[model samples]
Target: MTSFDIVFGSFLVSALRSATPLVFVLVGETLVQRTGSINLGVEGQMLVGAMAGYGAAALWGDPWLGLVAGAGAGMLLSSVHGLLTLAARANQFASGLAVWMLGFGLSAYYGAGLVGRKIEGFGTWRGAGLDDVPVLGPIVAGMTPTVLLALVVAPAVAWWFWRTRTGLVWRAVGESPEAARAAGLRPIRVRLQAILLGGLLSGLGGAALSVDHTRTWAEGMTAGRGLVAVGLVIVARWNPWWVLPTALLFGGAEALALRLQTADAGVSAHLLLTLPYITSLAVLTLTCLRDRGQAAPAGLRAVMDR
Candidate 1:
């Protein structure tokens, strides 16, 4: 391959790897929002999930188990948000903030012992039979299972929202919980289910970061990816299909930043690292200006207006 080809290929690979966790969290947040609920605590969930996942992998010597534990940890934390909002009738924003703080503290306390620990995580695909195929084979062989799963989940979620009966009901609840109640559907139950499912996926995203991406544990390692996912969800207009490309855009920015840093491009390392967040902020601003709540679920709009 030529130098240009190598460079381009490396960028593509890095982008895909970076995009994997975002895809999971973004899709999960989409579902929660579709139920007329917002989760600002995703960062906390991801952090706890990362810690639990890494700890599980180390204790059991199995990465898959770690993934499950991570998911469970996230779901467990999300239940607190559900209780405060659904049962106690607390403010969604306040509840979400509480959840975030709780997750942050819990992860830091629990993960302290696991810091710097390593585990055998998932490996890239071999594409053994595709060796004869050409460029596509080599590219496919480089992806880990988590990356492929993230790719599948985006389209699958889109299909579920548009094609399934349950999905329609979920959307209905999001648009108008009162209407759903009048229609004999249980809005609270549906929202709870959405919260739990979203938590499961968010946890999986965290697990992907620790076990599949970093293969190690650290406190607050998720940085602000969860918040970024929340912003991207709005930019996507809560559409699962749109999430794929939006996530890729962020991932590309992140990969580019890393590449530039490695190349010693003379830019401040701190500035380069901020590239992804800057991209997210800019895109979110433009999207909000252009759409102006035209596409937001009615329930979400009501919650935000309060």
Candidate 2:
């Protein structure tokens, strides 16, 4: 293979790896928002998940357990948001921010002891017999199961939403809660379920970040990928099927930043790290301008309208 092919292949692999966590968050938030709930606490949830997952893995020497603990932690936090928004009828935006703060503060406080520690987590997946092929070979090989799982998750979620009774009910709750209630569907109950499910997946994404991707814990390690994902939902037009490409778009930009840092270039390291955030902002701006009438769920749009 040519040198350019090698470099591009490496970049593609890195992008997919980096995009895994984002994909997890994107799919999760997509589910939550589809139920007419906006969760901005993803950053905090991820942080807590990272810490909890790493701690569990360290304690039990089992990465899978760590992942479960992380998901549980996320669910615990998201439940608070659900209670406040659904049960108490609190402002959804305010409740989300409160949850976000709780996650951030709680994670930082609890994770202080676990910082700088490491544990054995998931390893890379090398597809059998693919290493010998050119170009596509390297790109397909060396991916972790987490990344591969995310690849499958996007399509699975798309299928679930487009072709299932439960999925239809979930979407119906988001589209019009009143109509749902009249139709004998409990919108509040459905939203709670969606939020819990989203939290589970978000926590898994967090675990993937600390336990699988970095294999270590750090305060605020999620680094706004959660918020970036909020904008991506808009870019995706609220369709689960679109989440994959949008995630890869951000992932590609991040990979480019990493590659640029390794190369002999004039850009500052700090500036290089901003590539992902900048790309997200640019995409959000363009998407908002192009699709002013967002394809958001009816409930979400109503909330936004008020």
TM-scores, all candidates, are 0.96, 0.96
Consecutive 10-residue window with the lowest summed lDDT within model 2: 123-132
Task: Give the per-residue lDDT digits (tens) of candidate 1, residues 1-306.
Answer: 455655676687778889888898999899999899999888888888988998999999999999899999999999998898899988888888899999999999999999878798887766567434555654576778888989898899899998999989999999999999999999999999988888888888999899988887888899899999989999999988898899998999999999999999999889999999999999999998999878899999998766
For this target, which candidate reaches the highest lDDT against the unseen true structure? 1
Cα lDDT tens digits for candidate 2, 151-262? 9998899899989999999999999899999999999999999888878778888988898888878888899988898779888888999999999988999888988888
Error of 1 at 148 (Å): 0.8
The lDDT per prediction is: 0.88, 0.86
Which stretches of model 1 miss by more than 4 angstroms?
A: 1-3, 126-133
Q: Candidate 2: which pairs clash? A: none
Give me the overall lDDT of model 1.
0.88
